[model samples]
Target: KFAAELGRGDKVRFAGSTADLKISEVLSDAHAIADDDPDLETLPSSEHALPSEPATFDVMKRVDQKVVYEKVLDELASGGTLGIFPEGGSHDRTDLLPLKVGVALIAYSALEKDGLAVPIVPVGLNYMRGHRFRGRAIVEFGAPTYVNPDTLDSYKRGGADRRKACNDLLEEIEDAMRSVIVSVPDYEALQLVHTARRLFQKSPNVDARDKQDMSRRFAEAYKQLVARAGTDPPQKWLDLQERLLAYRRELSDLGIRDNQVPGLDRERRHAEAGNYDGDDVLGGGRLLYHIVHLVWVLCLAAIPALFLNIPVGILARVYSDRRRRKALAASKVKIHGRDVVLSE
Candidate 1:
C-alpha cells in the first residue's frame, strides 16, 4: 500500500535483484562440526528447496538483475523516488554499518544511462526506546547529495575504474548519512550520553529534533574523548561520568525521568506558562486534587499496561532473542534484543 502510494498508479515490486532458495541441514554427521562452525553451526545449506508451488521461477522473475536494474532506472527517469537502505539489512547497532555498494551502483547506473545526476537525500531515523510501544522517534533529513560527475566519468570509462567509482560514491553516501544519524559507540554509552544531555539541558521543552542534534554532537565528542583517553580518562571526565551515572540510576529507581523530577517540573511548568514568581506556590486544595488525579490515572494506566504487556512482552522477548542469537550475526542488540524486536 505504501509503495503503491509512492509509485502513484504503478505496481511497486520488492527491490532485491535476486532471492536464494535454501533448505536447512538438520542431520549433520558430527555434533563437534556443528559446534565448531560459525553462527551457532546450523546455518542453512546451499541446496535449493523443493518448489512446492507451480511456476515458482516465473513468479519470481521480477528478481532478475537486468529487470530490477532497469526498473530502478525507470523510476528515477520518471521523477519517482527510490528509498534504499544502503546498509542492506537492519540491525540494532549503535553505529552505522558499512554501506553496501548497491546504492552507488544505482546512482552511477542512472547517471550513466540517463545523463542525469539524481539527488539522494540522506534521512536519519532516530528512536528513543525503540522496540517498545509508544516509543518516540526523531527523523532528520540531511542535504541532498549528487554523484560526483568526475566519478561518473570514471565509471563511464569502465573496467577497474568502475569498481572504484562505485566505492567512492558509496563513501560519499555514507558521509551524507552520517551527518544526520545519531550514532553512539554502544547502548550503555547511549544511555549515559542521553543522561548527560538531560543533565545539562537548559530548557525542559527542547524539541526532539534539537535534542537529537545535541545527542549526535555529544555522542561524537564523547566517543572521540574515550578513544583519546584509552583505558584511563581524565579525572574530571570520570567524575562527571560518575555523577551522571548515579543521577540516572536514581532517576530510574524512583520511576522519575530526568524531565519529570518532582519540584523541577512544577517550577518549569510555571515558568513556561509565565506565571512563576519568586515564592509563589500551588494551593493545598489544588495539590490534593492533583495527587488524587495522579493516583487515579496511575490505577487506570496499570490495568491496561498489565493486560497488554504479558503475552506480547513474552512473545517479543522470545522472538527477538532467537533472531539476535540464531538468525542475525550482525545484530548488536543487547541480550534481550530490545532494539530489534518488532512486537513493539
Candidate 2:
C-alpha cells in the first residue's frame, strides 16, 4: 500500500517464509521417496513418523539460508527496500519474538561499504482478528534507527565480537517495536485489559480514536494495574480484575461485544441495525425527520440488498472458513506463540 512513496522501479524485498521456500522440494522428494519405498505401504499406521535426519531437508535448509541472506544483502546494496520480519516466522504471539541477527548484519554490511547508510525502519502490525477474513489491521511505523558508527568501529576491532554490535542494534529495535504494538502478559490478560480500556479508558478530548492509541493506553493501564498489585497486592485491584474477567466471559457466552451493551455509552446506544442518539423522539418535527431519514437510508440500501447474490455470498463464506481452518492448523504447530483467534 505504501509502494507509491518509493521511487519508480525501486524493488521491495519481503521476508519469505522458510516453509514456503522448502515446502515444494520437501513435498516432491517425500512423495517420490514414499512411492519408491515398499516399507511405506507396509507401515503399521499412516501416522508413522519419517526419519528425523533426512539429508534432503538439511541440504535444502542450508541452501535456502545462503540464497535468502545473499539476496537480502544484495538488495540493500543496490538501494532496494529490504523488508524483513526479523521474527523468523509468523506465529500468533502477543509479545515480539526474539529477533534474528540478519537485519543487523545487513545494516552493518551496508554501512561498511562506502556511501551506503542503511536505515532500519521499525514497523509494527497490530491485528484485530488475525485469522479472520477481512480483519481490521493497523500499521504503525516508528522512527528509523541505524547501526551506531562507533559500535561498528568497536565491531571492527573485535573481529570475533560481532554479537555485541548485533545485540545493541537488536535491543534498540525491540524497544522501538514494543512502543507500537500491544504486548500483554498472556491471552487472558489481553482480553480483560482490552475490555477495561474500551469501557473505561476513552475520553472525549483525547485523541484515542485509533486502535493503536487505545492499545497503547491499554498497555499503560495494565502496567499501572500490575504496579498496584505488586508484592503485597490490594484487594480492590484483585476484585476489579475478577469483575473484568467475568465481563469478558459474559460477552463471549452471549456472543456480543462490550460496546453493544446499553448504558455503556451515555451519548448513544448501539444496536445491530444502527446507532440511536436518543434525540430522535424529542419532538414531532424531529420524529418526522427521523422517519424520513430512516426511509431514505432504507431506500438507499435497497439497491444493493436487492442485487445481493446468494451463491456469491455462500462461496465467500466457504472460502473464508477454509482459509481460517488452514491458518488455524498451520498455527497449531507452535503452541508458545499462537495468534489470538477472534471473530469480528
- The window of 10 residues in a row where model 2 has the poorest summed lDDT is 13-22
Clashing pairs in 1: none
Task: Tell me which residue pairs clash in candidate 2.
Answer: 92-338, 92-339
TM-scores for every predicted model? 0.68, 0.61
How much is 56 displaced in model 2, in angstroms? 17
Name the runs in model 2 displaced over 4 angstroms. 1-60, 64-80, 131-134, 154-160, 208-214, 220-234, 248-308, 331-344
Give per-residue CA lDDT, model 2, range 1-344, as digits (tens): 22222322222222221221112222231232111322223223322334355322212222336677677678877779978888776766566555766788778877776436788888888875766657777788888887788877866665446767777788888878787788875667677667777777555344423656686778768878787777877888788889988888888898987766754555453454375455644675787899999999998988777678666767766766665566655542233322433331
Alpha-carbon deviation at 126 in model 1, angstroms:
0.6
Give the clash count for each candidate.
0, 2
Off by over 4 Å in 1: 1-64, 262-336
- TM-score computed on alpha carbons, candidate 1: 0.68
Which candidate should be chosen as best, given lDDT against the real structure?
1
Give per-model CA RMSD. Answer: 11.9, 12.5
TM-score of 2: 0.61
